[model samples]
Target: MFEIERRLYDEGHRFVACIDEVGRGCLFGDVVACAIILPQRYTIDGVRDSKKLSPSKREKLNGYILHDSIAVGLGRITPAVIDRVNIKEATRLAMKQALDNLTDKDGKRIIPSYVLIDAERIQTDIPQLGVIDGDNIVHGISAASIVAKVFRDSLCISWDKAYSGYDIAGNKGYGTAKHIQALLEIGPAELHRKSFISKIMEGKK
Candidate 1:
């Protein structure tokens, strides 16, 4: 996992921001992105893809990652915006927002020397590389994935209470059978992605 960071460090990039997003495939809520800069050559045991870890494990790692990171930033794109621009474009915007929001522990802005994103490039003047499967292969990107996943999952709890009956907490906004059934019965809440659920709504009629 450290290979990419080590290589980049050798190439003189000190602050390499690794970025990833969670909830892109969800049928509800905002898409959340994270950009994190770990100290050069930093390694944390048990850090891997967020999808591969249990919720408890991800939460545990999230605390450690946040404590150790030089800088952390988060971005969220609402369902309405996702419907307006499409998921692909919304995801890019979220990632860029994360980068633009990067700040150190003291809340001062930190500009990365380079950016390593997972599977997508954005419009940024900063030198960047989009690595396929970076969350599993890159240390910093994996840390960012854990942070984004944990953050979005926390939001699910609040959404479950606010929206009710959709099982948002259990499904974490994914399009599960129960969640879909609820959508058909009670209808979508304001947070549900209209563009993503149109077909599901049509099926009910």
Candidate 2:
């Protein structure tokens, strides 16, 4: 997964921040994005896409990545903002925020020379490449995915306390059979994406 990043590094891209998002498909909660730049030649064994790892494995990798990364930043757009702007734009906004957060107090720190995104492009002056399924093929993007997934999942788990019975922790706000059934029975929670829920309700009616 490091091949493309290594090549880009060899080509003089000094700091390559790999970016990825999670919870875009969730029926509730926020869409989260993470930007991460690993030190050159730094890697952990068994680092893979967040989807391919167990929850425990992802949690472990998330900590390792945080501890080892040169710079790391996270962004999230809530369900309300997501409904107003739509998922695509909300995702882009989140990604941009993630990139913007990769700065210091004076805004002169940890900026990337290049950005490798996962299947999406953002409006940034920084040179960026949108790689299809980048989280699976690029080590940096894979690390970003792991971090984002863990962060978003923790949010869902916390939200479960307030919005119980939907199994937000287990389903992580996805439209699982149990989640959809809960929606039908209890109506949408505040965290539920109204745009997505309205369409499903319309279909059922």
Candidate 3:
């Protein structure tokens, strides 16, 4: 898992940031991105892709990753912006925002010497590499995945309270049967991505 980082280190790059995003396919809520810089030679046991981990495990590792990271930053792009720009472009923008927001324990900004992203490249002047399935094989990207997942899941919980009936808490804004049924009955909440749900809305009519 550290092999990629090791290679970068050998290439004379320190302070490498690994990034990943969550909630891209959701029908509701913002897309969230995370960027994390880990110390050289750092490795956390049991860290892998967030999708493969149980929610409890992810929550536990989220804390550990944050505690051990050199710097951590998060970015969120709203549903409106996502609708205007499309999910792919919104995801890239969120990644850029995450890198821009990177800050140390003392709240000082930290610019990474290099960036490693999961399957997508953002517009950045910093040296970057986008690895296919990076969150599964790269240590730092895996850690960032956990952080982004936990954070976005927490937002879903809060949104469930604010906007009921779609079961946002349970489905996490996915197009589950219950969520689709609720959309047919109560219509979409303000947070729902209109671009994503146009078909469902048409079906309702």
Candidate 4:
């Protein structure tokens, strides 16, 4: 269903990277993009979108991908930029940055001949295919998704320490009952997306 598979182009059995991203839906924190290329022999069972898997499973795969995959690169777009340019464009920029950092399995900095990218069209001059369910359909993309999610989750947990009252640790920077309640009680912090929660507390003001 994608050019990555349509061509069957073998770039001499190096690494065919599949790229994916997460955290775009979060009202707080940065949007993260991760790109990973795995060797042909490398395989992980039951890999799918990070959202579908348990937190434990995602962490396990993080280890697997780190040890087995080729170059794994993470890119983050900050909250300030997301506020200024919007999430869609920020996500695009992050994804592009992640892809631009890909390297071959042989440890050389080179573009993959074919790429399977989840959702967004990777802004690169390389031959790539954007698959709607790429993370579920492709193993490499699933790896990237797990890597990005784990990294972002850890970052959110860390932020919870510095920025109290947001419940970012429990909510992982997402809008949840605890998170919304915190906002109602104490209001938003610098990291919180002001536009997202203003409606919930509109009547209070």
For all predicted structures, in order, the TM-scores are: 0.99, 0.94, 0.99, 0.88
Instruction: State in Å the error of residue 193, model 3.
Output: 0.3
Clashes of each: 0, 0, 0, 0
Alpha-carbon deviation at 48 in model 4, angstroms: 1.5
lDDT of 3 by residue, 120-196 (tens): 99999999999999998899999999999999999999999999899999999999999999999999999999999
Per-residue error (Å), model 3, residue 148 = 0.3
Q: List the global CA lDDT of all models.
A: 0.95, 0.91, 0.95, 0.79
* Candidate 3: 10-residue stretch with minimal lDDT: 1-10
- Per-candidate RMSD, Å: 0.6, 1.9, 0.6, 2.7
Off by over 4 Å in 2: 103-108, 203-205
lDDT of 4 by residue, 1-205 (tens): 2334434445453556678888887878888999887776457875778999999998987898888776877789888888888888888889888877776556677677677778878577777778888887777888899999999999998999999888888888888888888888887788876655668779567
Residue 63 of candidate 1: its Cα lDDT?
92
lDDT, model 3: 0.95
| Cα lDDT tens digits for candidate 1, 61-180 | 999999999999999999999999999999999999999999999999999989999999999999999999999899999999999999999999999999999999999999999999
Clashes by residue pair, model 1: none
